[model samples]
Target: MAEVHTVYVPRDTTACSLGAEAIAQQLGRHLAMHSPDCRLVRNGSRGAFWLEPLLEVETEQGRLAYGPVTPEQLPDLLAAGLLAGTTEHPLYLGPVDDIPWLRRQQRLTFARAGVTDPLSIEDYRTHGGFVGLKKALSMTPQALVDEVKASGLRGRGGAAFPAGIKWQTVLDAPADNPGNPQSGRKFIVCNADEGDSGTFADRLVMEADPYMLIEGMIIAGLAVGADYGFIYLRSEYPLAHQVLQEAITRAEQAGWLGADMQGSGRDFQLEVRLGAGAYICGEETSLLDSLEGKRGMVRAKPPLPALKGAFGQPTVVNNVLTLAAVPWIIDQGGQAYANHGQGRSLGTMPFQLAGNIERGGLVELAFGPTLRELVEDFGGGTRSGRPMQAIQVGGPLGAYLPAAQWDTSLDYEAFAEAGAVLGHGGVVVFDDTVDMAQQARFAMEFCMVESCGKCTPCRIGSVRGVEVIDRIIADDNRAAQLDLLAELCDTMEFGSLCAMGGMTPNPVRSAVEHFPDAFGVTPESSAGAA
Candidate 1:
């Protein structure tokens, strides 16, 4: 065995803050001058924030883990033969894969995530990557869509729509008619505007495995007969944007992108576009508007993005995770990938475990994992180590469930039945310290700030909702205010144009229903609307 060894460190934005890059550079220098056998591989984050700058050393015991390393300590550590003793570091003890949080993950889309050097084609190839592209090159487009359908994968982005159905719709659309009617251009738009708080999965994937997204888009283009693809990214993720740009350049130069990819007749090209910090842009049509350089506003449905999107063309607009998962599904057989999940939800979901929680990180799992397991076992309870009171599943649009409902499964339909949503799989845990009324008010304030003001209920209703919450909290006209708020929420939910208006009441309603004491409102106070 070589006296020297290789180390893997995360480079995702979250990991970088914990000093991942500096650690990698220091380790590399040490390997170059002092230890000829030692090498270092700068890898994408493993999605574990607290253990960032995590060093995974190749050892007889497997990949030994140590983390949150700083560059200044390299010399003494290197001199001590740290590579030889994998368990010596305070953070080191056992194989990283065997760690309970990591072990529990189903890891399909994220199979190569924290494990490989994301940019190196050689590294990716060595780890069973690009096999999907190779297999896809051998099959026809229709056959490819059929394979996806067999996999039973749905969009991991909030909606949980069937991915294969969207592909088929675009493939089967009517061609542009010259005189009487004509088929429009086919497009594949990747929704990378991940504006939800407590959710960084999309940004993590783009920063860590940019090539995967590009490869997935290329495969989608081939599957849907589309020549052009666009990734609509949020401006907040500057590092992710930069990383993706570099990856696209690398892939294009490597014959993985651009016209006539690898001498194959497929003429697919991809480009990245930045969104001007609009939360609604995460929605498909609003994303299209931002791509076209218009204000990000929700548009009507019926002619879904699949039927008419991006300049009135047949297009497939999917989320970052949804698109990133494609290459893997293609490489592996559909049944092989589909066999992991339960019920209507299939395959592993890359859930973003964040906010006021211990062991906060990325957790990829099959659909049936109960919220209780995610919060108690994986999250390890609240960050304050206090008993948790409420947990919010999904984004701001999601419902706040009291601890009694923790047993509910994480699937989309199950969450919907429980008056919640698995929107982008962001689970935020709040301990007893949390004020439910304040959280409820913050939801409305977020909506008010983000609402494009295109619709009456959302534009006017959110401000009123916040005022009503304030009135209820102040204990003045409490009963009338509570009644008014309920009536207002019902109006916005039923009369609003899009989810922005419709679902904003979820947090408010749940807070009011579950913890009425937080609002300081009596039962009689809810009797009449002011």
Candidate 2:
């Protein structure tokens, strides 16, 4: 009998979308007939999307990889000694870790992604999964909050607000549970409603390593004295929803969740609620409203979510990446995590590269790298193989950075200084064929379509913005239209209710300022508009 070997097939959304299921089925049937003893394991993607449906075979040396695999190629792969982990195959990518693309990433939060069977608790534990939660259980709540503060972790949901500060706010705010005065109810809401364009890290995290998020939320519950938690997930992520549900159930069964957390005498409960595809629900307040079965709309702040959130109780609302980073912070010590990046932007970010880029995938690196490095080095330039035009660093609402600004560091403050943002670490590249005018129009058009319609600026200003851009493009009173557009942007920026209206001008202004030619703004016309 031949020795049994383990074969890994990624079950991540990206992998499955690219036919990993078919590849897995093909491999399974082939293995049953030729090598019945071989074990097939479904794992999560390693964030190397260019190699989706990536297959790995465990050998005495290490896990050797073959990728972009298809069902049609299975017979040849098998014949080439794929079960024997042969390197002679053209698709063989050597040791998985040694692959330069995977090797260079600073994968802290995603340490276990793609490496373990996502549903297996034992696999998660074996690879140092619950170490942070265990360590967090031993510390005082304040101590844990202090550790997070020391780490300088910020909200990855675009605001870049310090996570530690928010945690401390929730920790200090008195829970407003009148019925249970002695043990008040505080809530931890994980904002998994990732609606930003060119962003999928949140979904990847949830589907690939559900337990990491679950463990992070549990630690947050402990840190802030929150007894209940809810993950407000977007409706598009059905796979993530299924995976999270299963992971939560397994967590409850394993004593990591439910009435008594690992017998520590602390109580924490968690549940997942689906969002109805409202882009505004990505906003924390709107998310809370949607979670409460109300129409998703932004709430005025001053009664911050920390003071009064879901159901009029103090709630700690954090983005998926923000919370998912907690367990690592607690286990490694805050300063250890802080030591990775420069300035106020501490630690690594899982930067998602998309849009007209070759080798597009997730690159987790420290915050100081320039956008050029990320786009050129890791992304391998534009997919069109043409001269690059614009680079949108943050999201749809983020600035359309011209080549001059591409050298700016990826830090939050640095990007702000350069009139750009590091919102959610989503870098979308565009080739020279892109029309900046159309792209700018799409920004307003998107705001118009996705706006919650609670505020006039976001709702009406966006509509006016689309009209003004069209007039300018048609060369109808170009200078005056440009001026009108600028003023409207100002009104939306200052008078609007939330970032939904305020940040809409970022892309519009950036396109006009950087690519004035595209907007039909000549030197004389620009001077007149100014």
Candidate 3:
């Protein structure tokens, strides 16, 4: 009998796109012919995208890694003793953690992301999963809410609302259980419809370490006295949807997500519902509307989701990151998690290094890394090998910071002061060749396309914005056009119904402010100041 060996391969979407599935299948065949005793395991991505189809072998020393493996190299890799970690392959990445990209990350919410089998409840548990949920089961709902509150956690889904405060409303609000009117049903909803450009944190959690999210939601359900929870995932994430469903089923079978959980006497049910892929559904109100099978539109908010969300019941709406952070806060005391970062931005954030960056992937870190450090040091500059020009922090709707503003820190208040936002912790870089005017115009065009049309400022102002930016780019009535653009942005910012238009002005204004030449304005004339 051949000795048994364990092989690890990624099931992450990016890895799959780069042929991870094919590589896994081929690995099975290769081992069957060459070394049949090897058993393969499909795990989540290491967030080192450039090294996709990364293969790992569980040796006595540790899990040795190899990367970007292709079908043609399988036999050579095998012949070179790849599984035994003796191969001198150029793609070898040594031990996974030894990689600088993986080492630098603070990785709290994403600690188990690349290490665990996404659908394996057993794998999840063996790797420090459900400890939070276990702890929450013993604590009173108020105590659980207080723990999260003390953790200094704010919503990671752009709003930055205190999650404990949001959950408190659900804890205090009257549950509107139409099915059992007297019993009072509340809800926990995970806003997994992550539509932000350059942001994949939610998707990574859903597809890679889904149990972390499930555990977080379970804690949330327990804390709010909610009997039901839903993960509103976007249709674009077929892999995430599939894996999450599998994980949910497994959790239910193991008695982690059934009607009665962990013998806690509380009843809860978890489900994954697909969204229509509309960007507006990212907003909690629109997400609630979509969850109800209504058109994905933002509802007016005085009632707040905490008071009247999800079928008129008090609801706790949290994004993937916010929910995923709960288990960490529970396992490590809230204060332990709180002590890592600066100011109100306590704890780690999964910063997605995207766009023109050379070493693009996820970089989870404590708050306070300057934009320059992220783009220049961690990212290793641009993939084009050109001088990095602009850095777009947050998502598409975020402001584009110029070189002058590179020293800006990662704290939410710092970004707010700099006229930008750390929306969803996405960082997109641009080389010197990027045209700021066209990019600025795209901000308006994106708003016009994605606007829910709930108000005049967003629906009409976005259309007018495009026209003005075009004139600015063409130098046609450039002076008046600049003035009109500024005024139009202010209207959209102040009057828009939701962030679709309200925040679109951020990128547009930032680009116009920093790069006047792109809009055909001479910097010395003060006309660009508009």
Residue 472 error, candidate 2, Å? 1.3
lDDT of 2 by residue, 1-530 (tens): 12438999999888999999899898888888978888999998898998888999999888989987987888898888888888898899999999898898899988889999999999999998999999988999999999999999999999988988998999999875676543367899999998888888998899989999999999999999998999999999999999999999999999999997899988889999998889999988999899889999999987899988888888899999999999899989999999999999999999999999898888999889999999999999998899899999888889999999889998988999998889998999999999999998999999999999999999999999999999989999888899899999999999888998999999999999889998888886676342
* Tens-digit lDDT string for candidate 3 (79-155): 77787775487877788878888888888888888898888888888989998888888989999998899899999
TM-score of each: 0.95, 0.97, 0.97
- How far residue 485's Cα lies from its native spot in candidate 3, in Å, is 0.2
lDDT of 1 by residue, 453-479 (tens): 889999999999989888888887787
TM-score of 2: 0.97
Candidates arranged by lDDT, highest first: 2, 3, 1
For candidate 1, what is the TM-score?
0.95
Scored against the true structure, residue 155 in model 3 reaches a CA lDDT of 96
**Candidate 3: regions farther than 4 A off:** 1-4, 176-183
Give the candidate order by descending TM-score: 2, 3, 1
* Model 2 misplaced regions, further than 4 Å: 1-4, 177-183, 528-530
Model number with the top TM-score: 2
Q: Which candidate number has the best lDDT?
A: 2
